[model samples]
Target: MSSVELREGLVVVAKGIVCVVTKFTSLDNISVISQKEGKRFIVPFDEIEFFPAVTDEGVALIAPELDELARNASDDEITLAESRFDVIGRYSCGEISLAEALVTLEMSRSNFYRLKKNYSEEIGMLSLLRYNRGNSKGALKLTDVVERYIQESIDEVYSGSSASISKVWSDVEAKCISSGNPLPSMTAVRKRIKMRDEKELYKKKHGADAASQKHDARPGKKIFSRPLERVQMDHTLVDVILVDNVRRQPLGRPWLTVIIDQYTRVILGYYLSLHSPSAVSVSSAIYHAALPKFSFLQKLGVDVERYPYYGVPEIIHMDNAKEFRSKKFESACIRNKIKPEWRPIGKKHYGGHVERLIGTFMTGKVHFLPGTTFSNVVKRRGHNSDKASALTFKEFTKWFVKEVCIYHGRKHSELGCSPGSKWAEYFGAGGDAPMHPPIVSNPFKFKLDFMPEVTRSVSPQGIEFKKCFYWDAALRLHVGKAAVMIKYDPFSLGTIWAYLDGEYLPVHFSDVTKSDFSLEEYHAQKMQGRGEGHTPAGGLEDRSLAEYVHENKELVKRSQSETRRARKAEAARSEYLSSQREESNEIDVPVDKTDKADRPNYSRRATPFKGKNYD
Candidate 1:
């Protein structure tokens, strides 16, 4: 259920008419004004259907720290808080009408509404506590001008090692004298400096690394007992070199993005590509993680009947990488009810789980592969990772899938049993606390929700994106109209999905015969000045694209360039080459088509992390 409280300023559908709540008459009765008709009337709470909030798309607003705010409240403050809670409770529960509750509390209607608003928005009872007795203890009481001068001095003069507290005090005293204000005592200046956050102060005084070493020490272990309760996601460049599909020449290492469930220590999902990790990588990994893997494994030619670990994680713990911090990534998480958490700026230990998992894969499995970089220069002294390379990307992907399955079965040092066994304890048939994990019903739509979104206006010819033109018959109706949203897959740019009306309408390239290629290949072409000309209004022909690929392949075979760009280009072209035969004309959405009879009828379980004791 959504956490938004039905209160004033919330928009809802009341008896099929869109209305905005004007005021709350009582728990059952809300006075609302119709958005269309501008008519004010009382709407029964049951008849109103709430949707996403006006802002933040449906993300629940996090309330303030109520316990800390109410801790130092006085006796009178406590009494008023209790009374306010009583009145709001009575009004909301319908035990007493709005008028009776208001009169009993001896408050005006406006104040009553205000109190209720505070209580609702503040996440219940403690919000009613009054904390405005006076300036808080230990808080600075310097005059505004004096305080500003002191802060400016500290920031400008004392932030460096050359300036001391005495120097800052002297600067502040000079400013006060010039402004005809009372000079602050040295003790006050010292107190202000002392109150500054240690890490930030150290960073300003020295540098980021010093501050990080002084602070951000490892904390206690993060314990999670349920699968998908807290997942850690991270990216690493795989240690082994990969070869191209066509010429078998060595390509560079590919970046692997892995998502691991913290409690079970099982690999939930991963995405591998030659391009560095970006928003696409993060989104693709998340899409793979939140949906079942049966069809995914089959596509990779792994014959696994059951890979029961798939669901939206309650919290995704990730490092403060640019990809994880992108607006598109955060918006997607919020839209899907997934929370994205960033570890402290300099704290590497916060991401230990995913980091250690990557280390284990590199040391235990990848180190033995042909053309392995062996993790560091010291380890790779006598080895030739490029000459020894043999595995192609497709073969490596298959190996990765099999390795993940094997890893799941291996007994974990901390769990005292295999991760697969731990997963089965909660979700397997006839096991302790057997429960069904949440699944995305429409996997295609779920994946689409995370694809990077773009908005463009329709033109007479079609929509142009990244120097390519896409058109569909459905776009004719809205040609040259208001801009509409579209999403494209980085792996394949043959078709882009246009969000028109309500559904996603597939928009194909203007040149219908052109084959699909990745975004990396497109950029590579542009970088070589081969993508300079205006694409024919009809779109670049398949013949030209094929010629470019042929040239790139010849270049790779002759030069065997180990540069990142050449490797990325080969990786992109190889994906197209390997999948040309198997690529489905229809979208590969992996929608669940399992027979109801074959699917297990496991009982649904509420998220286990909720209300769990943290202490």
Candidate 2:
């Protein structure tokens, strides 16, 4: 072989297999790591017939000698002779010395002399390359028996058997001995299996999903030009234990919905709830993302310079999660002129940025908390996360917000700058200022667009929804209208927006006090009261009255619990609304009570009975 062909890391053919040259042992011998079999072999220079040459553009150039030989010889002849003549021809023409050519070419001195004499006499180089087709030479070849044994072993392994290569080889040996047939070595069997492509092997063994994820990996890194141009949204079950707001008892884990800016690696918005991810979670996350964070921070009682990230992204990239793929979420994105891009099903790596962020947050921040699960089962084996829990929902929220702020200010490896600095660099510069999506003119209107909608008809009593009555003076105008669309927040069922003639009229619960209860709590109470026997008015049965009273008491308890929750939520909302109104330069519109007084009183009032007397 030429010196160029002996370079380390160059690929060359040895023994009918491709190997990479690791180092030269001598002028005649080189150490090579076989790419095909993954073993080290020290072979003579004459055994190397081809080596790869790559161009500047990364195109592989085929060996000229191999191409020339192919034109003059059959492919089977090349395979049988293993291209040894091409190496011999180079040495015979003074390309290299004879001592450097005779090390380990797998030929005896007599055979070499015979080949050299044949080359000198009758057939020339072609004669030197020819192999006697009938010469078996007592070498062991894989017979039909051995091949069948190998196929059986592979099938057993693919069938979920715990059989290792050694075990399979033992079985093959036992079968061959019993049948009085020769058995192939384990190395040969392993090589045959390795020659099969990984994708096909994994698919047969583990199934298609595993095969795709393991063997058919995807490209890394999604590029974006500016902040908020595109974002990734996903939900994760938080790894730290959280307690109920009022009871201060462990509530297992909370679910967090996060919106991440792809360009700057900034966490744009997040929502934490005890409930699982749903359309409500998606809406809340987007609503938070599209508004200033000042109000939210104020409501959380967190004092920061600013929580700068707030905008509607041009495109939101998410996995094909049920919540993300919901019609309500898609409709909201459309209504706001944003595009929703759902990654292909089972391709979780497409949303890798947010997934990595969740990992980083859980590892760096959450694991240090008192009630951390420590990510996986092994790490959490001895730790009772529930018992160690000390943080209430509010406390956790505060800590989470602070950690997010710290993350924004900390340097990111990918960005080479803090997320906050990147945001400032783009948004602060006037000429190339980051393009912010249009500000929401009215929070109520913006939220309504995203809130879940239901169709109902207005009646003389009111619009009945979720087993409750909602009323508005404007609803009277459309009392008989069928298919009136009502949009409401599941978090706070205190108010709803009724869509009529392209306008959404605000509606409140008919009994003002009942509006304080969320739909979930109301439903719970209704279920608890269902099927209870009613007591007779004239003659009350003690058992029936006791059951009725017990049901009513449960209802009252639920009502009180719901009222407390509503009060807290309302306070936060009030603070947020006040801040929003101030920021938007809008004044609160006062309702005209004169119209309320002039409207006919539909509410029932009791009149005193003048003539009724007890005997």
The sequence of per-residue lDDT tens digits that candidate 1 reaches over residues 538-564 is 675565587887899999877765577
> Each prediction's Cα lDDT score?
0.79, 0.74
Query: Model 1, poorest ten-residue lDDT window?
Result: 525-534
Over all chains combined, what TM-score does candidate 1 have? 0.48
Q: Candidate 2 — what's its lDDT?
A: 0.74
TM-score per candidate: 0.48, 0.57
Clashing residue pairs found in predicted model 2: none
lDDT of 1: 0.79
Residue runs of model 1 more than 4 Å from their true location after superposition: 1-219, 429-432, 455-471, 478-484, 490-495, 508-615
